[model samples]
Target: MSPTLVFGVIAAYFILLLVISYFTSRKADNNTFFTADKQSPWFLVAFGMVGATLSGVTFISVPGEVGNTNWTYLQFVMGNMVGYAVIALVLIPLFYRLKLVSIYEYLRDRFGQNSYLSGASFFLISQTIGASFRLFLAALVLQLAFFDAFGIPFYVTVLTNIALIWLYTFRGGIKTIVWTDTLQTTFLLLAVVVSIIMIINHLDLSVPQVFTVVTESDLSTIFEWDWRSGQNFFKTFLAGIFITIAMNGLDQNIMQKNLTISNTGDAQKNILWFSITFFIATVLFLSLGVLLYEYATTQGIALPGRSDELYPMLALNHFGAVAGIVFLLGIIAAAFSSADSALTALTTSFCVDILGLKRKEHKNQNRTRMLVHIGFTILMFFVIIIFSSLNDSSVVSAVFKVAGFTYGPLLGLFAFGLLSKRTVNDKFVPFVVILSPVISIILDYNSEAWLNGYKFGFEILIVNAAITCLGLFLLKGNGKNERLNEAENL
Candidate 1:
C-alpha cells in the first residue's frame, strides 16, 4: 500500500461525499440542515446510522478487544437492542410531540432556563470529547498509513482530516449526512466482510471451519459470571442499556437523524431497523476479531503491543494491497460517518440550544450557523490532538469510560424529567451536573481499593447517573403540579 495510493483512495471517497452534499444542499435552508425538513426516508436513516453508530473505534477496537475481553461486548450489544426499543417507544414520541430541534429543549420545557443550559452544556462537553476520541482513532490511522511516510506531523494529519469533513459538511449539515452516511456504511460493511473472507482464505479454512475455530477458541467466551469483575454480564448489560439511553436516546447526535423522519411511526421504524442491523454488525466485527486472533496464533505472527494495532498491522502489511485499500476505505468511511454527524449535531445544538438561533429573526442566520460549524471543526481538531497525547488504554474502553461520566449526567437529567413530575431549582443544575462526574471520577479511581477489589466497568455510568439524580432530587422544588402544568402549557 503506497502512501500515494492510500491518499488517492481517500480523495476519491471525499469527492463522492462532496457530490452527495452538493445535491442535498442545493436550495437548502436552516430547516433542511437541521431536520432534513422532516422528509428523510426511514430506511436511509436506518442504514446510515449503522455506520455512525459503529464509528472508527469499533472498526479497529472491537476486533482488537476480543484478544482480551472476548465476547462480553455482546452483552452490551444486547443491552443496546433493549435501549433502542426504549428510545423508539419512549423518547421518539416525546420529541415528535414537542416538535424539538434540539432535544435539550425538553429540559427547558420540563424544567427551566438553567436546566436547559445545564443539559446543553453537558452535551457540548460530552460530545466534544466523544467526537474527538472517535476522530483521534481515525487521525492516528491516517498518520500511520500516509502522513508518517511523508514526514508530516500528526497535528497536520488531524487538521487535514477535519478540513475534509468540514469541506463536505459545512453547507448541508444533517441533510448531507443522511445520504452520505448511507454510502459510507456500505463501504464500511464491505471492508469487514471482505477482510473476513481474505483472512479465512489465507488460513485455508472453510466458512464453517472458521466458525468452528472461533467457537473452539478461547476468544469466543462471551459470558462472565463473576460478580465483581467489570465485564460481568449483568453489569455490562445494564450499563449498555443506560449508555444507549444516554448516548443515543438522550444525545443530540444520534437522535438528530431519527428526528429527520416525517413522523413518529417512521422514526420508530428507523430505530428498530437500525437496532437489529447494529446487533448483526457487532456479531460480524466480533467474529472478525476471533478470526484475526486465530490467524495470528496459527501463523506464529507476533501480535502488536496494543491489541488495537492488530487489525491494521495485518490488513496493511500482510493481507495484500486489496485488503489494505479496504482497510483504509473502511476506517475512513467509519470515521467520517460518525464525525460529520457529530460536527453537524454540535453546530445544531449550539445554534438552537445555546445561541437561540431559531428564536431570533436574524438576517444572517445561515452565515452564523456556518461559522459555528467551522468553530466545532476546529474544536474537534484540538481535542483529538489532546486525546492523542493523553490516552493510555484501548480506545473502546476509553470512549465508554468517558461516556459513563459525561453522559451519566444526561441520563439522570432526562430520567428525572420523564419519571418524576417535580422540577428542581434550575440554578443548581450546572453545579450538580459538574459535580456528578467529579464524584464518579473519584469513585472510579478508588473502586478497586475501596470496594475490596471490585472493579467498575461501563456500569459506572449507572453510578454517575444515580449520583446526579440524587443531587437533582435534593434540589427538587415543592411545586410539582405547578411545574407539570407549566411544561404542558409550554
Candidate 2:
C-alpha cells in the first residue's frame, strides 16, 4: 500500500473519533465526568466494552498467537465467559447498592481507608504501566509500518499519537469514552470482518476448506489437561474466572464503565451482552489468523520472530494495497479504543479515588478535574516512550509479573468483604496486602531455583490469590464477630 493511502485512512479515522468526542464532551460536568449521570444505555456500554476488552494487545497479539501457540488461547477467552457471568451476578449488585463513584470506595467501607488506597494504588500502577506499554507496542508497530519511511523518530510518533487521544478524552471522561469506544469497536470489528472475507477469497478456499485446514493443521485443538503446564484446561478456566473477577470485577478501569449504565439491572444485562459479543469477536480474529497462516504457507512468506507482528506483516506483504489499508485501520481502531479509555479511567480514578475530587461539590471541581486529566495524559506520554525504548520482551513480561501481584490482593479484599464478617485490623491491612505479594514474589522466584525444574505460568495468579486470602485471615481480630457470622442464622 502507498504511504499516502495508509496515512489518509488513519487520519480520517482519528477525525471520526474526535467528532464523537466533541459531541459527547459538550456540557460535560462532574456528574458526566464521573458516571455519565448513570444514564448511559446498557446496550451501548456492552458494545463499547468489546473494544476496551480487546485493545491493541489482543488486536495484534491473539491472531498472531494462533500461528505460534496452536490456538490454545481460545481456552482463556472461553474462560472469560464464566468470569463475566460471575461479575454480573455478584459484583454489579454490590457496587450498585453502595452507590459508588469509585469502586475502590467499597474497600474503605468493607475494610478501611488504607485498604481503599491500597486497591486504588495497585490499579494506578498496573493500569498506567499496562496501558502505556500497550500504547508503546502499538506505536512501535505503527512506526514500522508508516513513519519509518519519513524518518520520524519513534518518540515523536508516540507523542503525536497519544496527544490525539488526550485531545478527545480530556473533557468528557467516562461519558465520552462510552460512546467513542463503541464507535471504535464498530470500526475495528468491521475491519476484521472485511479482512477475513478478503483473505478467504485471496486464498481461494471455501469456508469448509478453511475450517478443515485449521482443524487439521494442529492449531484448533482446545483442551490441554496437564495441570503443570501453562495452557492446561482447568488452569485456563479457573484463571479465567479469577482474572475476570480481579481485573474486570475489581479494577476501576473496567468496572467504572460498568457502573456508568443506569442501574444494577442494566449493568448486569450489559455484562452478559459484553461477554457473548467479546467471545464471538475473539473467535473471528483467531479464525482470521488461521486464514492468514494458510495463505502464507501457500505463498511461502518469511514470518517475523515475534508472533505479534504476523498479522500486520502479512497484510502489508501478501494481501496487497487493500488489505494493507484495512490492516492499518483495524490497528488504529483497536489501539485507540482501549488506549483512550485507559486514559479516561486513569483520569477518573485519580480525580475520584486517590485525589478525592469526586467527593467535592465545589463549582471549580470541573476546572481542577480538567487539570488532573491533562496532567496524567502528559505523564502517560513519557512513560510510553520509556517503555517503548526498553523494548525488551522479558522486561515487559516482568512488568506483567509485578502487575500480577496487584490482582491477588484485589481478589482477597473483595472476597473478604463479601464472604466474611470479621473486623480486620485496619492498621495491619496494608502491611498484610503489601507483604503478601512481596512474599509470593520471593517464593515464586526461588521455587525454580530450589526445586530444580519447577515452572509457572498463569498459576501465579492462583498462588497470589491464596497468599492474599491468608493475609486477610492474619489481619482479622480475635473474638470479632464475623461479618457474615450473624447472617447465617437468618
Candidate 3:
C-alpha cells in the first residue's frame, strides 16, 4: 500500500498498454481506427467485451452493494442474457446488413437528418457522463489510496488518468482497444479470482465451505417478488432486457467493437458468446461481495460510510500488499477497458453522425477524428470533477439511472424505425425524442403517490421508450422505407 509502490504499478501498466498500441497502430488509418478494418477475431471480441460491459462500475460498485441490495443485481444480469440474445438475432444482422460504422447513421437513413442527430446527440451525452463516472471512481481511488500520500491534488490524478488513456488510444482507436481489452479482461478476472482465494485463506475455509457460506447467507438473496419494490424480479428482468437493448444494442461504444468482425455470423457469435461469459463474471463479483462482507464482520472492521468505499478500505489497509495490488489492477483494468473504447466511439460518433466526416475527403478524416478524440478527453476530465462533487449514491445506480433517460430515446427511435412501415415527419423527430424522457421523469417522481406506493426502478427505461414511441406514432408520415432491409452495394 505504499504510495511509491502504487505509482510504480500504474506506470508499469501504462507502459504495457503503450507497447501494445505501438504494434497494433503502426499502419492504422481512419478505417483502422473506426472499424478495425473489419478483421477482428470473434473470440477475442467476446472475451474482451466482458471487461468493457462490466467496466469499473461493476468492478468496484457491484461487489460493495451486496450489503445493501444482496444478489438482486443477478436478476438484471439474467435480463441481460435475454437482451443480448435479441441483439444477436435481430440487431446484429441489421447492423451488418447495413454495413454501419456509427450505429446512429441508421437514424438518418430511416427517419431523416433530424432524427439522426438527435440519436447521436443522446449517445454523445450519455457516453460522456457514463465514461466520466467510471473513470472518476478509479481516479478517486488512486487519489485517496496513493496520490494523497504524495501531496498530489485530485485534479492532477484525474488529468494523469485521462492522459494515459489518450496516450494509447489516440492512434489505433478501436483496433488498439480490441487487443488491449482482451488483455485487461484477463487481468481483471484473475484479480477477482485471486482476491477470493486470498480472503478464503485468511478465513481458513475451503472452496466448498466458502461457497456454502456465501450462498446460504442473507447476502445471497437474489429475487424479490414484491411488485412495488424497485428490485422486484420482474422489474429487474425487464429493465435488464431494455437497458441492454439501449446500452449494448444501440450503443455506438459497444457496437463499435462488434462491427469490427468481418461478417454478420461472426459478429452474432461474438455477442452470444459475450452474453455467456458476462453472466459468469457477474456471479463471481457477487460471490466476492458476499465474502468481503463476511471477512469484514469476522475481523471486527468498521464499515465505510459509503458502500462503494468498503472494498477499497479493506483491500488496501487490512488485507496486505498482495490484496492491494490485486484490487488496483482489477479497477484500473476495468476503467480503461471501457473508457478507452468510449473515447474512440465518441470520436467516431461525432465525426460521422454530426460532422459528416465520411462525406469529406479521405485525407482529412483522420485529422478530425484525432481532434475530436482530444476534445472528448478534456471533456471527461471536467465532467469527472463535476461528478466527484455531486455523486452521493452508489455509482452503479447513478450510471443506470443516467442511461434510463439518455438511451431511452435511442430505443424508441430504432424500434419505431424497424417496426413500422410509415416514415416519421423528420423535422419533428428531435422534439419527440427530447420530450419522452422529460415525461418519464415526471411519472417516475410521482409513481409512488400516483400508483398506491409503487416505485419505479430500471423499468423507467421501458416507460421512457414507450412514451417516445407514442409521440413518434402520432407524427407518422406517408413515406415508406426501402433502404433498411437491403444491404447497400459497396
Candidate 4:
C-alpha cells in the first residue's frame, strides 16, 4: 500500500465524517450534544453501538488473539451478552427514570457529593485509558502503514488523529456521533467480511472447506476449564458480565449514547439488539483471525514478533491494494467511532459531573463545553503517547485490565447504592473507592500464591468492586439505611 493511498483513504473518511457532522449538528445546542435532543431512532443507535463497542481493540487485537487464546475470548463475550441484558433490564430504566445527563448523577442522589464525584472520576480514568488503548492500536498501524513512510513521528500522528475527532465532535457531540457511527459500523463489518473472504480465496478453500479448516484448526479452541488460567470459562465469563456492567452501564462513554434515545423502552430495545450485533461482529473477527494465520502459513510469511501486528501487516503489505484500502477504511472508522464519542463523553462528564455547568446557569454554557471538549481531546492525545511507551501486553487484554481496576469503584458504588440502602459517610466515599482498587491490586498480585493457586483475570473487577462495597458498608452513613434515592432527592 502506498503511503499516498493510505493518506487518501484517511482524508476521504474524515471528510465523510465532517459532512455527517455538518448535517447532524445543524441547530445543535447543549441538549443536542448531550442527548441528541432525545429523538434518536432506536435501531440506528443499536447498530452504531456495534462499532463503538468493538472499537480498534477488537478490530485488531481480538483477531490476533486467536493465535494464542483461540476462541476463549468468546467465553468472556458470552458473559458480555448477559451483562448487556443487565444493563438493559436494570440500569437503562434507572438512568432514564432519573432523566440523567451524566449517569454519575445517580450517585449524587443515591449517596452524596463524594460518591457521585468518585463514580465520575473513576469513569474518566477508566475510559481515558480504554479509549487510548483502542486508538493506540489504530495509530500504531497507521504509523507503520502511512506515517513512517514519510518519516513522521508517532506523537504527531496521535495528535493528528485526536484532532480529527475533535473537529467532528466539538459541536454536534452525540448527535453527530449517532449517525456517523452507523456509517463506521458498516465499514467495520465490511472490513471483516472482506478480509475473511479474501483469506479463504487465497487459501482456495470453499465455504465448507473454510469452515472445516477453522473448526479443525487447533487455534479455534474456544473454552478453557483450567481455573488457574486467566481465560478460564468461569473467570472470563464472570469478568465479562461485571466488566460490561461496569464499563457500559456505569461509564458515561457508552450510556451517553444510549441516553440519546427518546425513552427507556427505546433505549432498552436498542441494547437488546446491540448485544446480538456485537456478538456476531466479534465472531466474524475471530474467524478472520483463523483465516489470517492460515493465509500466512500457506504463503510462507513470517509472523510478526507480536500477534497484534499480524492483521495490519497482512492487510496493508501482503493482501494487495483492495484489502489494504479496506483495512485503512475499517481501522480509521474504528478509531474515530470510539475515540470521538469518548472525547464527547469525557467532556460531558467533566462539564456535568465536575464543573456543574449544566446544573447552574452560566453566561456561556456552549463556550464552557467547547473548552472542556478540547481539554479532553488534548488529554487523550497525551494518554495515547503514554500508552505507546508503556503498553507491553496484548491491547485487548490491556484494555480489559484497565477496566478491571478503574471501573471497579463505579461498579461497587452503584451496586451498593442500588442493592443496599446503607448510606456511607459521603465525604469518605472517595477514600473507600480509592482503597478498594489498591486492596484488589494487592490481592490480585498474590492471588495465585495466596489463594491456593487461584489466578485473577478480568474477574479482578469483581474483587475491586466488592472491596469498595465493603468499605462503604463499614462507613454506614449517618445511621440511615434506605433505598436508591428518589427524584425528590435530586
Candidate 5:
C-alpha cells in the first residue's frame, strides 16, 4: 500500500472522531467531561470497552505471540473471566454505593489523606506509563507504515499521534470516548474478521477446514502443564485474575467509564457483557494467529525476526493492498480507542484527585482542566519517546511487567482498606507502598537464580501485592479509633 493512501485513511478516521466529539462536548461541563454526567448508556459503555481493553498492543502482538508461545495466552484469557466477575460483583457495587467520581476516593474515605494520595499517585504513574507504552507501539507502526516512506523523523510521528488524540478528546473527554470507542471497536473487529477471511480464501479452505488445520497445528496447544515454566496454566490463570482486578477493577481508566453508568445494576451488566465479548474477541485474535502461522508455512514465507512484526509484515507485504488498507485502519482504530480514553482518565484523575477540583468552586475550573489535559498529553509524548528508545522485549510483556510493579502498591492499598479494618499509620503508608514494588523488582530479577530456577510470570503481581499488604499490617495502628484520629489530623 502507498503511504499517501494509508495517510488518507487515518485522516478520514480522525475526522469522524472529531465529529463525534463536537456533538458529545456540546453543553458539556466539568461533570460531563469527567463522568459524562453519569448518563452513559450501559450497552454503549460495554461495547466501547472492547476496543479500550484490546488496545494497539493486542491488535499487533497477540497474533505474533502465536508463533512463539502457541495458544497458551488463552490461559490468561480464561482467568480474565474470573477477574471480570469479581469486578462486576465486588468493585462496581462499592464504587456505586460510595458515589465516587474517582475510584481512589474510596481510599480517602477508608484511609487518611496520605493513603489517598498514595493510591492516586500510584494510579497516575501506572496509567501514564501504561498509556505511553501502548501509544509507543502504535506510533512505531505508524512510523513504519507512513512516516519512514516520507523520510519523516520518528519523534515527529509521535507528536502528531498525541496531538490528534488531544484534539478529539480535550473537550468531551469520557463522553466523547464512549461513542468514539464504539465506532472504533466496530472497525477493529471488522479488520480482524476481514483479515481472517482473506487468509482463508487465499488458502482456498472452508470454515471447517480452517478449524481442522488450526487444530492439527502445534500452535493450537492451549494448556501449559509444565509446573516450572513461566507460562504454566495455574500461574497465568491466577495472574490474569489478579491483573484484571488490579488493572481494570482498580484502574481509573477502566472504572472511570463504569462510574459513568447511572446505577449499580447497569454498571454490573456492562461488565458482564464486556467480559463475554472480550472472551469471544480474544479467541478470534488467537485463531487469526493460528491462521497467520499456517499461511506463512504453507506459502514458504520467511517470518520476521521479532514475533511482534509477523502480522504487520504479512498483512502489508504479502496479503495485497486491500488487506494492507484494512490493517492500517484496524491499528489506527485500536490505537486511538485506547489512547483517547487514557488521556481523558489521566486528566480526570489529576484534576479531581490531585487538584481537588470537585471540592473547589473556582470560576476557572474548565480552564484548569484543559491545561491539565495538555500537560498529560505532553507527558505521554515524552514517555512514548523514551519507551521507543528503550523497549527490547515483546510490547505485551513489557506492559504487564510494568503493571506488576506499579499497580502492586495500588492492589495492596485497596486490599488493606477493604479486606481489613485496621488503619495504618498515615505517614508510613507512602513508605510501605514504595517498598513493595522495589522488593518485587528484586525478587523478579533474581527469581531464577535465588529460587532454584523457579521462573515467575505475571503472577508476580500477586506476590508484589502480598508484600505491600504485609507491610501495611505491620504498620497498623493499635487503637480502635486510630482511623478516626488520623482523619481528624488531616
Candidate 6:
C-alpha cells in the first residue's frame, strides 16, 4: 500500500466523522444534547452500542490474545451475558423509576447526597481514565502509521486525537453520539467482515474449513477447568454477569443510552437484544483472531512483537493496500464510537450531576453547558497526553483495575440503597465512598506481593462491593424515614 493512499483514506474517514458532527451538532441544545429529546430509536441505540462496547482495545487485543491464553477469553463473554441480564431485569427498572438525567442521582435520593456524589465522582474518574486510555491506544497507531514525520511525539498525537473527539461531541452530547455511534458500528463491522473474507481468501480456506481449522487448532478451547487459572470458565462466566451488571448496567455511559429510550419496557428490550448481539460479536472477533493466527503460520511470517498489533499488521501485510485502508477506517470507527460517547456521557453527567446544570434550563444555559463540554475536553486532552507519555504496557489492565474499585463503589452505593431500608449518613458517606477505592487499590497492590500471583482480577469488584456494603451497614439512619427514602430511591 502506498503511504499516500493510506493517508488519503484515513483522512477521508475522519472528514466524514467531522461532517456527521456538524450536522448532529447544528440543532442540539441541552435536551437534544443529553437525551436527544427522548426521541432516539431504541434499535439504533442497540446497534450503535455494538461499536461502543468493542473499542480499539477489542479490535486489536482479541486477535492478539488468541496466541496467549488458548482463546480462554470467551469465558468472559459468558460473564458479560449474565451482566447484561441483570442490567435489563434489575437495574433498568430502578433507573426508569427514578427518571434520572444522571443515573447517580438515584444514589442521592436513596442513600444521601454523599452517596450520590460518590457514585458520580467515581464515574468521572473511571470514564476519564478509561476513555483516555482508549484514545491513547488509537493515537499510538495513528502516530506510527501517519505522523511519524519529523519525530512528532506520541503525546502530541494523543492530545490531537482527543481534541478532535471533543470538538465533535461537545455540541450534540448524546444526541449526536447515538447517530454517530450507529455509523461507526457499521464501519467497524464492515471492516471485520471484509478483513475476514480477505484473510480467508489468502488462506484458501472455505467457510467450513475455516471453522474446522479453528476448532481443530489449539485456540478453540472454552474451559481451563483449573480453578486457580486465569480465564477459568466458571469464574469468567460469573464475572461477566457481574461485570455487565456493575459496569454497563449500572454505569452512566451505557445506561445513559438505555435511559434515552422513551420508556422502561423499550429500554429493557434494547438491553436484552444488545446483550445477545454483543455475545455474537465477541465470538466473531475471537474467530478472526484464530484465523489470523492460522494465516500467519501458513505464510511463515513472524507475528508482531506486541500481540495488540496482530490484526492490524496482518491486514496491512497480507491483504495489502485495499485491506490496509479498510483496516484504518475500522480502527477509526472502533476508536471514535466509544471515545465520542465517553466524552458526551462525561459532559452530560458533570453538567447535570456535579454542577447542577438542568437539561430544561433557559436559552442562556447553553453557555454553561458549552463551558462544561470544553472543560471535559481539556481534561481528556491532558489525561491522554500524560497516559501516552508514560507509555504504560499495562494501560488496559490499569483501566479495568480502576473500574474494579471505582465501579464497585458505584454498584455498592446503588445496591445499598435498592436492597436496604436504611438511609446512609450523608456526611460520613462521602468518606466511606472515598476510602473504598483507596482501600481497594491498596489491597490490590499488596495482595499480589503478599499472596504471590494471587492478585486481583475482575473479582476485585466483588471485594469493593463487599467493602461498600459493610460501610452501608455501619450507617443506622432512623427507621421512621426509611420507607420514605426507599420510595424515592433510584
User: Where is model 2 more than 4 Å wrong at Cα?
Assistant: 359-363, 394-402, 449-452, 478-490
Give the winner by TM-score: 2 or 6: 6
lDDT of each: 0.91, 0.78, 0.91, 0.89, 0.89, 0.79
TM-score of 1: 0.97
What are the per-residue Cα lDDT tens digits for candidate 2 across 372-415? 78887888888887776666543324444655676778888778
* Model 4 C-alpha lDDT per residue in residues 1-490, reported as the tens digit of each score: 8888888999988899899999999988888888888899999999999999999988999899899899999999999999999999889988888899999998888888878888889888888888888999888988998999889999999988888889998888899999999999999999888888778778888999998988999999999999899989999999999999998888898999999998999999999999998998888898889989989998999999889999998998877789889998899889779988988899999999998877333449888999989888888888899889987878988888878888888899888888876678899888889999999888988988898999889999999999988898898767663535763332
lDDT of 3 by residue, 1-490 (tens): 8888998998898899999999999988888888999999999999999999999999899999999999999999999999999899888988888888899888888878899999999999999999999999889889988889989899999999999999999988899999999989988898899889889989999979997999899999999999999999999999999999999999999999999999999999899889999999999999999999999999999889899998888888877898888789888999989999999999999998888877333767777888899999999999999999999999999999989998999999888877776677889988998999999999999999999999999999999999999999999776565545442321
Against the correct fold, how does model 4 do in TM-score?
Answer: 0.97
- Model 5 lDDT per residue over 1-490, tens place: 7888888988888899889999999977888888998999999999999999999888989999888889999999999999999999888888887788898887877777888889999999999999998888778888888999999999999999999999988988899999999998998898899899989999999989988988888998999998878899999999999999999999999999999999999999999999999999999999999999899999999988888888888888888888888888888888888889999999998899999897233559989999999999999999998888898788888899899999999998887777877767778889999999999999999999999888999999999999999998999775663333222222
The true-versus-predicted C-alpha distance at residue 297 of model 1, in Å, is 1.6
Residue-wise C-alpha lDDT for candidate 6, range 341-409, written one tens digit per residue: 888889888888888888884767888888878888889888887776675454435566667887888
What TM-score do all the candidates reach, one by one?
0.97, 0.94, 0.98, 0.97, 0.97, 0.94
Worst 10-residue lDDT window for candidate 2 reads 481-490
Single out the weakest 10-residue window by summed lDDT for candidate 3: 481-490
Candidate 4, after superposition: displacement of residue 478 in Å? 1.7
Give each prediction's root-mean-square deviation over alpha carbons.
Answer: 1.6, 2.6, 1.8, 1.8, 2.5, 2.1
- Each prediction's total of clashing residue pairs, residues at least 3 apart in sequence or on different chains, is 0, 4, 0, 1, 0, 5
List the pairs of residues colliding in candidate 6: 79-240, 79-241, 80-240, 82-241, 83-241
Worst lDDT window (10 residues) for model 1? 481-490
